[model samples]
Target chain A: MTWTVIGTYATAICLLIGSAFVMVGTIGLVKLKDSMTRLHAPTKVGTVGVGAVLAASIIHNFTFGYGSYHEVLIMAFLFVTAPVSANFIAKVNIHERECDTPPKPTVDEHWATLKPNGIEKMPDQPAQPSNGG
Target chain B: MIDLFNLPVGDGPGATFLAWSVAISFAVVVISQILAMVRVAVGPGSGDRILALDTMVVNAIALIVLLGISQGTSIYFEASLIIAMLGFVSTVALARFILRGDIIE
Candidate 1:
């Protein structure tokens, strides 16, 4: 009985926090201007917002149903992929010339996204030794 | 807990609080979904649209989890998980298509 009460309140708190973060994140998504700036917002939703809700689910299940950790799988998968997708989106912005071009690399003639193909050697590739086959 | 569909008030303070929180969160998430939809519709660039769509997917996942909590069941877990995976894949693919003019190559 005690654990039930505790779990219920815990779940409620988690739900509230999660919902608040999700709301804030989405608000930022709508309100922020510029594609690069817009990219900053939804990541909040991806990480903390969904994370807290998943925590609530886990707690609620343990308290009132057959407890399971399967939700963790979703959480982990989201965590792993959110940044990768975000990076891809940013890359798209760069490739499309939608966002500010990054500062010139000190060591390379062109940013990777803007680099002309084949005309210049790839910056990261080492030059072959003259004697090597 | 008060079921949103059934509208029965729960028996105790904890249940009542949880139910109310769940209801409020549902409203908030739905509002976020609408906001994201607006962004998707009006976004100036494809990146913005893609980002908004990603946000929508994340919000959908949150909505499903809330549904699970309200119904007091674990069965929805699989649905949310599949959505998460698919959403991520779709976001990456869309971005890649924009970047490279191709998804696989």
Candidate 2:
């Protein structure tokens, strides 16, 4: 009985927390001004929002149903892929000129995404020796 | 209200609290989904739209997990997982298409 009470309350708390984070992240996505700045918002949904809800599901399952760890697979997948997708989106923003251009690299003339033409040659290839070795 | 789902309101006040909290979270998640849809509709750039869509996908996963909890079932887990995978793949594909004008190259 005591365990049931602990589990139920914990699950409820997790659900509420997850819902709050999801709300905040969506609000950020809608309200933020710039494209690059807006990119910063929805990541919370990918991380804490869905994460907390999945945690709630795991707790609820253990307490009230047959326990299973499959939800962890979903959680792990989300954690692993969130940053990759975010990076891709940022790259799209840069390529499309939707966001501010990043500062010039000290060594390179252009950011790789902003390079003219389609990857024609490697940047700054060392000169081959005129004399054959 | 707690009796709506007919969930097992275990022999304590916590059970009722749990049921109510789940209901509230369901409503909250739905609201967030709508907000994300709004972003998708009016976003100034394609990047914002893609980001909004990604947020919507994550929100959908949250909604599915809540449904599983409220209904006391684990079956929705697979549905949410598949959605998560599809969401990531679609987001990356869309971004890649915009970046290179080709998804496979």
Candidate 3:
């Protein structure tokens, strides 16, 4: 049982754990209802699953001296982008139903960016009479 | 059969443990994917379907990364990147469709 062997074993175990998390996330996707709930499934899985796999790769690379942390950069990119993408899609979906208009072409500008914090704006609603009429 | 880069099958920690771990993880992923498939198939609305697809894509990317680790190859990393890029595109497209009823519009 050399150090090299032990390192590989650790990396392999990490990879497996990461993979298992991903699978659970997918199961959640199947069990949950609506687009919002489904969107949540991937976020939970992608973060930890990608993290574990990348960690495993880092360990393997360190032990074997194969590649640099370049793959890690990819993992980082995924971590940042996956959730944003999910949120974008979910937002657009919500807006479409509320507006009864076509979904906006750009979710970032039309839905995510413009959406007020906590308070929802209904475009079709008329203003209340200040005079109590 | 110990190599500087890779742990030789027998020399390092016996292939049995390594193989079993990979197998178990692989099984878990498969089962999860199956469950996702059920959701995708049974979802009541288009939005639910799209969400399921997104989750499926993420799971697929995870599987690829794990495979890369098991095989000790960088090929799977590239595939994982492609999947990541493509997943975003498909999700955006689907979301657009959900809103506008068309991808381009």
Candidate 4:
């Protein structure tokens, strides 16, 4: 009984948080002034909203004894693929002349999106630790 | 929990809460879906429209998951899985075509 209650609360909270992220992403999708900025919205959905719902599903299934973990496959696939699609879409935006003047390159590698190579480039930021691999 | 809320026809403890939460989230997702459609119809550029469409696909997946939970069914899970695959492939193909004028290369 106690575990059931705990699961209920957990599921509710996860659903709330997940839905909130989805809402925010939707708002960002439509409201952001730039195409690049709009990309940020679904990226949030990709990470937070989807992850939360998957967590909720996992909890609900486990608590109700329906056999959990199938949600993980969807979650993992989304996590792997969202960034990929985001990258391709960003490339599309850049290729179609959607973004503004290319920002100055921070390192030896220039912004790959700006080049015709079309191999894709991760935006350089001071915060990200480059190349975990 | 249903009695605590003083509502009739409760399924179980926290049933009302879970249902209400799902209901509210459903509304939120619906709002987003509408917003995405508006963007699609009023796109300033094809790129923007494509992005909007991409977002819509993802939002649909989220809605399907929520629906599965509310309806207490597992079939929606397969729908979401298929959407995930289709959405990714379509987005990649469209974007690739836009970039290089050809999808197969």
Candidate 5:
């Protein structure tokens, strides 16, 4: 039927697009110079790429009479959670690396603020030498 | 009316072949994911590893949907949904731990 052909063509198109994204992601994983750039690759490609392929499957299922919505629920779930998951992973990675430069501070800023609770200044203490004895 | 849009009346009307095409596409996604995993394993930085993990989760979701199509069942959908929910939770927990060094803080 015409619907079936339409579904096939649509699925093919989705597959092509998804594959392209996956390939790009893979290349980025290999070629990106640093952690932040690497994060962008999978987030851009992996989430949306799988989404497109899953959408195509849903269409194919509906057209073939395997039931109109067998795979739709899965598609919905993926859409809901994929981005959140990516964000989480990126955050964790940023945290674990503990790069010398904290994410919040800019290059020109002082690294840390003086605390008001610190002991009132004592007469400058003489430097003490450690005795290894 | 339904047959009006059907393809030129060849194998295009069959269900099995359509399922096969979906399977093939899913296979491609899985293979690409495995390639991503290689990066995860050899990653010189934690961020690259996390990126690979995220890619793996997405590939799993795609595989579940394709399974539903191939098997003509809704059960796989439920499993996929469960995975999605859990994956989101884990990712959030991990992220919080990374940023603040404690899940609660």
Candidate 6:
């Protein structure tokens, strides 16, 4: 009976904390200005919010003899993919000129300043038109 | 006797507290989903909408996990796993489309 009580408190507290994190992430999404700023919120969802809940799941499962580490797999997958997806989104934003002007460099042209030519060459390289046709 | 798999529902505050906490988690997940939708609808740029869409996916996964807990079943785990994979792929695809105007090279 005592162990059950401890487990319950642990799980409940974990769930409450997890839900709070999720709330913060979503509120940030709705309230933040600028596309760049908005990108940070979902990342929080991927990290703190989802992670806390999964911890609760792990704890809850222990009480039921469902001692499985499947949650670890889910966590690993999310951690790996969240960054990749965020990177892609940032890249798209840069390509689309959706972000604000970046800080200027004194010696060289900043990558953000370059206008990415569609269906063309590398991002940091100059556009080279073919003379073969 | 330990069932080694039975839920710990002794004459304690375990079950009741878990139930209430899960309910609260559900409410939070729903509110997050709504906020994500608002961002999607009013987002100024394609990138913002893409971010919002990804947030929604993560929020949905959390909800699925909560559902699994309330029902005391582990089956819902599979669905959340799949969603995680699909969410990443779709977000990348959409962002690629926006960046290059084409998905394939």
Q: How much of the real interface does each model capture, measured as fnat?
A: 0.85, 0.91, 0.54, 0.62, 0.55, 0.82
**Which ranges in model 4 have alpha carbons more than 4 Å from their true place?**
A103-133, B1-12
Mind giving the per-residue lDDT tens digits that candidate 1 earns over B61-99? 999999988887888998999999889989988987876
Structure candidate 3, residue pairs in collision: A103-B99, A103-B100
On DockQ, the stronger of 1 and 2 is: 2
lDDT of 4 by residue, B1-105 (tens): 433323221366777787677778788888988998998998787778878888888888888888777765567888999998998898888888877778998
Q: Interface RMSD of every candidate? A: 1.6, 0.9, 2.9, 2.4, 4.1, 1.7
Model 2: per-residue Cα lDDT at residue B17: 84
Between candidates 3 and 6, which one is better according to TM-score? Answer: 6
| Residue B38, model 6, lDDT | 96
Instruction: Order the numbered candidates by DockQ, best leading.
Output: 2, 1, 6, 4, 3, 5
What are the per-residue Cα lDDT tens digits for candidate 2 across A5-112?
889999999999998999888899999888888889888888899999999999999999898889899989999999999898888789778877889789967787
Model 3 TM-score on a 0 to 1 scale? 0.73
TM-score of each: 0.88, 0.90, 0.73, 0.81, 0.69, 0.84
Question: Docking category for candidate 1?
Answer: medium
- Taking the tens digit of each residue's C-alpha lDDT, what string does model 5 give over A1-133? 5776787667656756665676677777767777777767776554667667667666756665464554556556666776676666655554455334454456633322211122232223436333322
Per-prediction RMSD in angstroms? Answer: 6.1, 6.0, 8.0, 8.7, 7.6, 5.3
| Rank order (by TM-score, best first) | 2, 1, 6, 4, 3, 5
Predicted structure with the largest lDDT when compared to the true one: 2
Per candidate, the number of residue pairs that clash is: 0, 0, 2, 0, 4, 0
- Scored against the native two-chain complex, candidate 3 gets a DockQ of 0.42
lDDT of 6 by residue, B1-105 (tens): 332224344546556667778888999999999999999999988888999999999999999988777766778889999999999889989988877667887
**Docking class for candidate 6:** medium
* All candidates: DockQ: 0.65, 0.76, 0.42, 0.47, 0.39, 0.62
List the candidate 6 regions with Cα displacement exceeding 4 Å.
A103-133, B1-11
Clashes of 1: 0
Colliding residue pairs in candidate 6: none
